[model samples]
Target: MTSLPEDPSSPIGESARDTAVRRLQEAFSEGHISHEELDGRLHWALTAKTHGELVAALAALPAEKAGTTSTIAAAGGQIRRRGAWQVPRTLKVASAFGRVRLDLSRAVIEHPVIDIELQLGTGRAHITVPRDAIVDLEGLHTGWKDLRYKTRRSSRPGGPTIRISGMVGFGRLKVRHARR
Candidate 1:
């Protein structure tokens, strides 16, 4: 996935209804929705004033799946896997416009690379990595704020490579790399 350009300008102060209408119009223009469907949903979203109402309206939109499939397994939004002998393992993660939690504290791999593509809305996320592993990061992009990284030690040889890219609306991302 490609990174979205950051917009440093101030956010629009329109009401939820207005915002919904604007989003619907943009979606239609972008060919994400048909005219009749856009009209129906735009009416509902525009009339939604409360947070729950707006969420409901937005939830009616089409569903899109993110992330990748490899030796690792992901189900019900949780990822789990075990490495086998005589095989090099890799893990890839991706999330679009939602919250994603990654717990790599129990991972056991000779060599691993974690690639994450995030498109967050307003929710925050936390990512933890092994300290003894080497982490090489690349392709990190965000729309609302700068990507944040916190690590204790520097990268070492034969360690893991963590790549992140995508868009964020209003939220903070914290990544902690610690030794095992």
Candidate 2:
């Protein structure tokens, strides 16, 4: 652990803690640790008061593997990806004047967190996430129509988090969780 101030709320310390927490979640999703272990490590990482404690929470975990991003775009037509497709760690979807549909109910997801950047200019974008997944839209910007998302209290809490970002100009973005 790099020597730093002992305050956990400091800028550097907070960033380090966030990274450690993400790594722990990734390790859990990658099957490197059990759910119980993940819970314990996550607690340690979240409540760490010092950089040394933060580093200890990530002990024995290997560095995160680098992954490529996949992009699907359409200038004036529709874009769709369904069935048992393989999901990359990062994805970019853009549509200029048509519909966009992404169904991830049966996709092969290996990452603990997936980042999807959507750029839709004048159409609707629909996303069907897995039942246990968490969707984050904090970075998304919309216009004219509000985003549609139905939140549920998931029984299983350790699934991958799907983060949707980017902008949607003059269109609607609908997001729903899978039934199964």
Q: Highest TM-score: give the candidate number.
A: 2
User: Which portions of model 2 miss their true places by more than 4 Å?
Assistant: 1-64
Q: lDDT of all the models against the reference?
A: 0.53, 0.87
With candidate 1 superimposed using the best TM-score fit, by how many Å does residue 142's alpha carbon deviate from the native?
A: 1.5
Candidate 1 error regions (>4 Å): 1-98
Estimate the lDDT of model 1.
0.53
lDDT of 1 by residue, 49-143 (tens): 45555555566454322432344322224332222222223344444334556655556543344445655555565666666554444565566
Q: Which pairs of residues have clashing backbones in candidate 1?
A: 97-119, 131-178, 131-179, 132-179, 134-159
Quote the lDDT for 109 in model 1: 44
Ten contiguous residues minimizing lDDT sum, candidate 1: 1-10
The alpha-carbon deviation from the true structure for residue 135 of candidate 1, after best TM-score superposition, in angstroms, is 3.4
